[model samples]
Target: MSTPNPNPENRQINIIDPAFTLNPQPVYDEVLTRYRVAKTIGLNSPVISRYEDVIWALRHPEIFSSEMDMHVGLGTERPMIPQQLDPPLQTRYRKILDLQFSRARVMEIEPDVRRHANELIDQFVDAGECEFDRDFAIPLPCRAFLRMMGLPQEDLELFLELKNGIIRPPIANPYDIAAAKEYRAKTGKRIYAYFEALIDDREKSPRDDMMTYFTKVELDGKKLTRNEILDICFLFLLGGLDTVTATLGCSVFYLAENPEHRRRLAEDPSLVPAAVEELLRWQTPVTIVPRILKQDWELDGVQMKAGSMVSLLIGAANVDEQEFGAGEGKCVHFERERNRHIAFGAGPHRCLGSHLARMELRVGLEEWHRRIPSYSIKAGETPRVSPGIREVMYLPLVWEKGGAA
Candidate 1:
């Protein structure tokens, strides 16, 4: 459990460090095998990367509290509800949220999801080339979220900008911890302000949307406060826009490179569901999950003190050799059996929109391949990958015009 000098080489690694962002598997490979738990640079928290350890930590949220102060250090003014709350409170908010994103409810929009995916592909399928991220990956998910939230489609660009500002801002230097924190604070305030206006608007002119539901939704016989609603709105806005986009981009990038796999999925549409899980495990967009220690504890011999910050490395854990089998972690196998991936996370705080995410991912892949079956990474172009929230940016794809359709 405890290994003195786990990282004897002292190879500098931080979740946000460029080296870590560009390719994190190497770092994870080293740390996960060397020590189930270890510390890293740039991130003031200890890193837990082993599959079992990460699962243990997530399942036991009481000890490893999710009450992370994500308020940009500007205090309670911009609290991210449910995500930053614990137990009873977190449970209450999640109850209300569960109803809206329930599997049955999300399925009701499957037709629209399919329609939107085709609509976006319609723009570039005939051209024989397109930037997958911009033309397809990005817009499809955002449009679905807008349709679900009943938000104006025109505001997609604005909301996308705001989401990036908080999660992955256009930083001059991503490793600059101080600067990134400051930028997020400013962006978070803008998000808070934006939601406040929406909440106020719905209060006067109620509509049939999630925003209105939050305004009237009650917990323990009391309506959710303005702050609580803002927190929910804030969390939903980010989750709706980013998570699926990240997954779609990663999956498409893989498909572009692996035509064999693409052909199989396109030929056998039923395989798409199984393929989705493997892709999520392989290209986990969410890399770091942060939690604050409630009390001193020793996990697998690693001593962590109370109040310390511990990061459950989901991206690393998903590929852990111990869980996924030796050498298999690196291989993208669509027919992988017993593939228990924590891409959407685990335990009490598992992604509320997971149903919607799975639908969007499946529909996006199914519809695209149904339209354009054969494609590959454009010649001389390589996708740009990031570290912390592992992603494939600007995936340029090309195919023979009318050849595979």
Candidate 2:
């Protein structure tokens, strides 16, 4: 194991650029090199980019707090439900929510997921060209999440708008913070109120869905409070909507660009699972996970005082030559055997809805391959969106109509 140099040479690290939006390679490379030499250092904020340092930080939760409110500063005060809570208590909340995302539960939702994907494709397949993000990527996961939570499908648009605000705030403009704050508060309240009523309804008349189970769950010999249940529900809504949306958009974009990779999967239909992992590694939708230092520690050579903020750059780590081998780091191969990537994060904080997300992606890819496998990016018309916390948005593609016929 190579240790980061304590008195390493200073190197210029580029944290941001005006031109780049989707592919943030320069920013990531700079951070990775700097973190390798210095262990932990301050950038836009402090970053802990090396794979080992990040894994250590995630494992040592006591020393690296997951209480994001403290780390996120005044930006967000609402507790992040189970994510913001630590052990024992955190485990309890996670257990209550885990059942909803369990493999069996996800299997139950597969038919609905396929139905939703086909329904969206049916609308746009005839158009021969459509903005995938708007037409398919956004609605598929949004509707799946709604169905899983037993929420009204009519509120999908509202849920998406609010969820995006929470995860990807407009950090470029300081003025946007106030608007984001207002949106957070308003959305948080509305979501809480909505879930609270749902909880009440479930308690009065329980059903087989998640809300009923949440209402009846007890932690440490006491029923979960209304606020806590609402917070958990909000987390589910935000986590499911944005992360899955970005991932699906990125995957579709990859297929459009790499027609060979798309062709292989389209022909062999069985390759969808491996292709999903490859897309996750190549795109890495959830780029960074921030942790607060609870106690003094030394990592990758740099000394750190307690109370410092550190971020794990999953995007950079996924591409590290030391981990993934030469040419393997590139997105060319979709069937790599050892395709373990931290796209869903790791450890206790690992994405709880991973199974459901995978199911959604598999269904989307399978259905898409059947209907619209041969698509290309529109000429002179590039699809793009923000690459901040979430890395993708709009993806436009053109296909020949009746190709599947």
Candidate 3:
């Protein structure tokens, strides 16, 4: 909202700094206040921090495209459907994905999601405390998503391991590119192999699930190939598995740290829905989305060359005063009248699993507060969040083992 620094100094932000990952708001505030666009010292990409610029780039994917040839590093053999593609082709795939993830269809999965939420709580509530991320945040979505896809729910642990292997490879050095790629490639193979068997099963007996839908759905009057379904499922493994978990982790952590906000939701259940949106805005789990420039583009006098990657700071934009607080930039309230935050992103590739995510978050929160209404971060233990998705991986929460518990 503040005028782009007319004579801005060279601002270099460490996009992946552990400290920044732990507490990124200060960095975001600094960027939003001083620079419309800055450069990431680690990734070396131009960081678009303003809400307007990020939204414009997202909407106009013709200029700022999502299609990139860097799948190997992302633990994928090929570009995943809809997500890694641009419009027209991307739009067609979305047509099919959108129907499968429509609100009505997501609503049908709600009862099971709610059941799983409460069931996860049942294990930890009696103990009066639990490591929230490891216990609840991860498994709930894993099982629910697997069930929704008609996959074997019993393989949730395997799926979690496989997903983590790709995202956060279990190695001593996080910065070892050779080790990281080797691990990701191995994990990618296993992921493909895992889905290949399931694809065969789904095809042998086409069922009433999303996996089957992918196998049968015709795009541009042609049925999707086996690889296409595998690609879609691969994207699902990344997007569906990680994003919702990140949202849940961040949402629960926020509630745990702020008692009044938690009390408001516990006392008045209706606020849970709005609270989900607010949390999504304030603590955008998927902090940065990568885009490649199809052609040269410039914003705020900073030139971005063609084919270079651009980092759209969704978290920074969501809290920008220009759009959020009428130029205040500190909008963290659940009762706000309007919140056009692109937390799920904007335009043709806006998250395909958003409906399911909202239902999961809303249900996850409703059932969580209903069971454990009074809780907080355990004393003397600092929670740790991840760099990319901003997931609070080690959130220890405690409460009295009675009343709602």
lDDT of 3 by residue, 1-405 (tens): 356643333888886788988778998998998888888887788889888989999999999898998686877889999788998889988888888888998899899999999889988888899998889889988988987888887899899999999999999998999999999999999999999898888889998877788778898899999888889888899888778888999988888878889999999999998999999998898999999999997788777789999999988998998888764457568897888889999998898889889999999999999899999889999999888888888999989978665
Best by lDDT: 3
Minimum summed lDDT over a 10-residue window in model 2 is located at 11-20
Q: Model 1 clash pairs?
A: 1-300, 2-301, 21-386, 21-387
What is each predicted model's overall lDDT from 0 to 1? 0.82, 0.74, 0.87
Highest-TM-score candidate: 3
Q: At residue 21, give the lDDT of candidate 2.
A: 45
Please give, for residues 26-108, the per-residue lDDT of candidate 2 as tens digits: 65566565546432223434556666666666777888888756414322346767888777667777776776689998999
TM-score of each: 0.91, 0.90, 0.97
Worst 10 residues of 1 by lDDT: 1-10
Error of 2 at 403 (Å): 1.7
- Score residue 279 of candidate 2 by CA lDDT: 85
The model with the greater lDDT, 1 or 3, is: 3
Segments of candidate 3 deviating more than 4 angstroms: 1-9
